[model samples]
Target: MLSPRRLAATAALLAALTAGVLALLVTAGLITFGAAAVTVAFLVTLAALAFLVLIVRRLDGKAHRIDLRIKKYEAELARTTTALKNIETRLDLLVQAVEDSAARRADDLGAILASLGEDRVNAMARAREVEELRAEVRALARDSV
Candidate 1:
């Protein structure tokens, strides 16, 4: 596509040519006097229009550059999001592993507690037997007294 600047430049060149031709025609006494003045005025207005077109073209170039930068940022955001998701996935797996390990440890602790209870019962039975033996010895001592 033709840039606005190029379009405006072409329009200005055409206008200049038109003016020159009309002036030549007027000098040559072909066009009437009043018509040449109007023609020149119209041709002169082309310069402002040309300037406007140039400004638009400059804006267009900047817009294109900005659009490219935006696309680059968008791609970077997508990549970052994907990496975050991957990290989250790894974290979830780690949490699950920890939970599983904790559950197994709890089961092991329960078994240890059960074994301790059995040991406590056995110790209590031994303590009762010892107390009975001591009572027998005291009874013999009393009989001797």
Candidate 2:
């Protein structure tokens, strides 16, 4: 397929050749001046129509290519959207797992602190009992003396 510029140039050349032939026939006294002029006008009109058809066809082809590109882009966008959704779902699951582990660790720490508190109370009670035993021994020694 010829480019629009080349097609226009070819049309213009054809129109010019036809007009030159008509003008020569008029000069030779073969056709009247008015008839020659009308013939030349008709030939130029035909050439103009051909040029317009070529331009319209070229524009249509470009439009088809653009439509194909648009469809391809739309498909790619859909795939990207689906991938993003999957990633979001995985991230949500990971966050939930981390939160659950943290809750378990916190519970374990609380139990350990409670056990330490009980141990401290038991130690205090033993210290008081030892003090009472020591006082009783001293009282017995005084009576023996």
Candidate 3:
């Protein structure tokens, strides 16, 4: 669970330590400086590489978590959009029903108006016909007298 920063610092210190130990030994007439420098360079490179690898791994974990969060939000948005669509459909059906009821009521009102008009016209005609029959009867009775 060590971070890249800690690992790099540790590796760099270890490399310095090895170089110092070798130089001390040489001062004591033990090893060569050229070999010591070469070993120090290799250790430094290895430490840097390990640190770089650790940083990359940390970044990859962050990316995976971000991807997972994005996917979860995407699914939630999709579900909300579907719910909105369903609500819209229901509203549309309700509007259609309201319009149909209004149209039916209008048609019923028009039929009732037409029926009243016809009844008024028939009543006037019948009254005129009875008046004419009574006038004819009166004239025939006077002629017979």
Comparing 1 and 3 by lDDT, which wins?
1
For this target, which candidate reaches the highest TM-score against the unseen true structure?
2
Ten contiguous residues with the weakest lDDT in model 2: 3-12
How much is 128 displaced in model 2, in angstroms?
Answer: 3.4
Assess every candidate by TM-score: 0.64, 0.80, 0.69
Candidate 1: regions farther than 4 A off: 1-36, 133-145
* Backbone clash tally (model 2): 0
Model 3 has an lDDT value of: 0.86
- Candidate 3 regions exceeding 4 Å error are 115-145
- Per-residue CA lDDT of model 1 for 1-145, tens digit only, reads 6666677678778877887898799899998979998877775776677677778888998999999999999999999999999999999999999999999999999999999999999999989999999999999999999
Sort all candidates by lDDT, best to worst: 1, 2, 3
- Candidates 1 and 2 compared: the better one by TM-score is 2
lDDT (C-alpha) at residue 56 in model 3: 91
